[model samples]
Target: MIKVKVSLRPIVSKINLPTVVKTTILPGDSIESLFIATQVGEIFYIGNGGIRTFLDIRPRIIKLGGSSGGYDERGLLGLAFHPEFYYNGLFYLHYSVAGTQGPVAFSESFKPNPCDPKTLNQRWINRETQYDHIDTVEEWSLQSNGQPQKRRTLLNLRRPFLNHNGVNSLNFSPETGKLVLTTGDGGAAYDPFNLSQDNMEIAGKIIEMDVVKNTFINNPPVVTRFNELPAPIQETLTVMAKGVRNIPGISFQRFYNQYIKYVGNVGQDLVESIFSFVHYKPIPVTQLVQASLMNSEPNQEGFVNFGWRGWEGGFPTSTKGGCSENPTLDEKTIAYYNEAVNTSVSRLKPLTSYFHKDQRPDKFGGTALTGVQAYMGNGIPDLTGSVVFSDLARVEESRSPVRGVLAYTRVRTDGKLNDFSVIETDYNFGSQSAYYVSLGTNLDQTKLYLGVYGSMKVTDCNQGTVFEIVP
Candidate 1:
């Protein structure tokens, strides 16, 4: 890793919290334009020498930051343009639907006790009445008149808790030419229901939907599992991987003729991990449902699994507690010992991982992985061909003004864990907290974008600024 320092040039300011940032050309445009999607359900594009509203779906978004005490993960979380958007005028969105909030799956915060078997194997029952909210994925098109309108509904997912419904969730897969949706392990801490490893659970999995297939179901049923979906919808989806805790989004980097996929799995308690792989086999949702009905195991050869609930990054998932004998030392108990062994061989190894608490002077402790993208731009030569990522905030003890971290790492050719180097930024935030909420790139990934917020709360309006990482 090389020491890299860059400048943050502010492009847009006074916006709501940005959850997704990317670039796409409008139907009639000749050049690519930057688009920013806010958590409060507004999409703006930099065009005509000013920030213009591309779409506003606030009325359709669930009321945010009320129940969560000024902070929330439920809102407009994902936005993506079609691969052929220049000709098709198609795009997709994933957001928490308005008027669908319900009782949480668990009445209290969840922490698995390894000594108590009941806590370790709890199931999510009474799902219909016990759920947090519903997230909907839909296809929208920019009409000939230059107005965006909903084309059809793709998926209506029932989420168990308020968090872990991924940020920057919707993306178009270049390899398969399908729309990819990456979601979290239905939110409660430590995955109380163990949904990630379950074959039927829709949460905690990377799914690819073939948008070309017209299922004709304009309004899909709101369901938590794959078995509950209509057969037509099931036929169009394939599961790329499972055992995800929470993900920022998936990024694809061109490597010769193939694409290298990079995914950042937000840590549970210990570490934040970024995994890269060039090959995978996706299993159709239909086959998984049929296998469950027949009580047979579907062939999982070439499948990708991150091993959540059992393994977090490169270590076994553990619960941390202060040591009784030593007041300063923390004790960690393996949360799921049995699970760690079962999935050890099948799960994919992370390309790089950074700790929540690091003692190294050169590394900063990570709070949460906000975004990850591969930068192919030559503008910053040191960061060229590297995977760049952002953290919500660095864990600097007793720091007055909290600041987020920007770092880069490279994939190893030997399939082993690699280290990351922090990319120092020259921009100063002064007294305000700057939480890096999201990261994005242009159509060709030759440019990088950073979304910074002054506050962590969604209720804090007009505190966001989108910047470009420049030399």
Candidate 2:
């Protein structure tokens, strides 16, 4: 399997460098935190408690300030933490905004009136909340005198692509804790006046909500708003499953003790995925609405169609079947032919893919799988149920076997996806003065006690570093 067409070059060559250490759990105050989505718009919260104490790390922005708040696409993209998050402080975000002045065509439906005027086939829905701010789901609380207690939006999005406001990721359901949203495919390319494969009312899918049903006006015409809050806690978006295309990441795979699994991440343009949310566990929803209203094929149930615009990750549009190795077929398993052409749109065969093709000149911007973390490290004894992934590196080029560092695993408890290793490779570490190595456990057991908060540049400023990954 060595078919060559090589032209990908970006070499500095230095290999094997993993032994970092510069720990900060609450030192000088920095309770380990780092979540970013920055083109610079704003979704910043570097570390340590508020009243502003950023000794330095570049992003401290988190807006909602006057003039009805502002921050266009606003930078910050996605971050999630709330399985119970101790006791519900719940968090979820996705940005990009600045379109109320009105008139911005490309529609099949978008009537909210900015002055109304859109045409991709007619689009201008905003009457105030055609979907509102791409996507927002908040429920914060920490004001014992510590700030941050006024964030309650719980699902809001009306974004028609300023750049795929397909929201990013928010996963929860360690077993019916209920909350899984990975939307995208509501934009980019087409669905133009069709509002994403025949509008089910709101853009491109992968939604499932019920963080404990806030009644949502008793699910009114598909949940509108529950008596404007104060009905217990209010939160409901129950749409369980739907066709996906830009699901940055959504996860859950426990494997022992009553087994629970659901994982997703697909973004076609060269086929990219991780899927196995068991197509919403073995069928039957009136056979997925009689295969979406009186048969049209594509195995209905919960939905998992990884092939968009004819095929990307599964190849075919020809750049040599989208990226080489042609001769008909040579990879085998394309997620079992993207669930048999997403449950019967017919014409199977196209799942297991991992092609590189000179690493990103364009193929919908290279191997996408932005973020995935599931390694509950108490300090890795017998490797305490492993799973670690973060590939936010979108082709800075370097033969991309996943640029920079971090990729680990253990997956097996029936959801099967095996060991495959890389442990951790350096991304600089806390050096530049103050960022240095070895902390927490050791004496023999290999080594483990890693907890690192990220972002570093130093001299020109882009700081914030909390480290430790000893061995």
Candidate 3:
């Protein structure tokens, strides 16, 4: 990797935490405009040299940061414009619904132990009253008068934890022309119930929905699994992949005629990984349901898996503790030996994996992966045709004035793991903490955007800034 340096041009400042930042052409507009979706259910766009509120659904969003000590992962997490938005004025949104929070699924934190079979095979029972919150997907259209209105409800999902709901979760696939939704494993540590690998669970899978085929259901049932959905609604969905721990979002980079899909899976105490693939076979929800009812396995020959709850990036999932005798050293134990062996051959290898604790002088330790985008822009010549990503914050001993990290990596032709280089930026934040919360690109991938927050708490309002990655 080559050394790259860029400048952050501030677009807007003093706003709420942004979850999604992308460009789309508004109805009757001649050029594309940058749209920013905040975690508190507000969408703003920059047009005619000023920021304007495009939509506000705060009344409909669940109360955020109440149970998590002011830090939250469930709010307005997704926003996507239809491919024909300029003419059709259609768009989609994914967010946690109001008045739907429930009791925690478990009384205590979860950790898997290989010696105890019961701990390894815990089940999520009494789901109706034992969950964290409900997230809803909706379709909205821009009216002729330029205001956005809700068109229909697409799907409602039940999450089991307060975190790992996935940030920037909604996107449109350029190849198949379908809306893609990437979800995290129902969020206790180590996926206590193994939801990611289960074919019936919807928490940790990548699904595609055909919005063109309306199911005519105004109020869809809130469910946790594939078989519980209405038949008509199930017919419009297909599962693309599973075994996800948590994801920032998915990106599609055009390569000749096909698009190379890029996904960043946030790691659990080990390594942050980025996976790329150009081919996959998505299984329809109807087929999965039929197979479940018959007690048979669906054809998973061409399906994709990220190998969660077993393997974390390039290493088998393990627990770490300090060595009693040798105080300077740490002890590691494999968390799930059988699961690692079972998924070893089926999971896709990541293109690149960065460690949580790196000793190399050239590399920095990563905390959590927040965003990933492919930059095809010529403004930063060295970063053209490369995949760029953002970390919430680097791992360091000091806590004050925390700063995030930016890095870039490329796909290799030999299908081997590649290394990345840090991208230094020219910006002065003084003594304020800056956490990179989100990343986005234009429709053509010719421009890049970065969302930075001054604090980690979503309740700390008016502490965000949107910046353009410029040369």
Q: Which portions of model 1 show Cα errors greater than 4 Å? A: 322-329
Q: Which ten residues in a row have the lowest lDDT in candidate 2?
A: 10-19
What TM-score, to 2 decimals, does candidate 3 have? 0.98
TM-scores of the models, in the order given: 0.98, 0.28, 0.98
Writing each residue's lDDT as its tens digit, candidate 3 over 1-471 gives 899998999999999998999999887788889999999999999989999999999999999999889988899999999999998999999999999999978879887666667988999999999999999999999999988999999999998888888889999999999999999997979898999999999999999999999899978998999999999999999999999999999999998898889999999988999999989999999999999999999999889999997989778898764224565667777887889999999999999989899999989999999999998888889998889999989888866689999999989888888999999998999899999999999999999999999999988999999999898
In candidate 1, how many Å is residue 459 off? 0.6
- Show where candidate 2 strays beyond 4 Å: 1-138, 142-144, 147-168, 171-180, 183-205, 208-235, 240-246, 249-270, 273-338, 341-355, 359-365, 371-391, 394-471
Tens-digit lDDT track for model 2 on 254-303?
A: 55554334333344434444444433532322333334555465343444
lDDT of each: 0.94, 0.37, 0.92
Error of 1 at 40 (Å): 0.7
Query: What does candidate 2 score on TM?
Result: 0.28
Q: Estimate, for each residue in 1-471, the C-alpha lDDT of model 1 and write its tens digit.
A: 789999999999999999999999888788988999999999999987899999999999999999888999999999999999999999999999999989889888888877678888988889999999999999999999999999999999999999999999999999999999999999979988989999899999999999999999999999999999999999999999999999999999999999999999999889999999999999999999999999999999999999997899889999876224665667888989999999999999899999989999989999999999999999999988899999999998889798999999998887778999999999989998999999999989999999999999999899999999999
Model 3 residue 54 distance off true place after TM-score fit, in angstroms: 0.4
| Candidate ordering by TM-score (highest first) | 1, 3, 2
Better of 2 and 3 by lDDT: 3
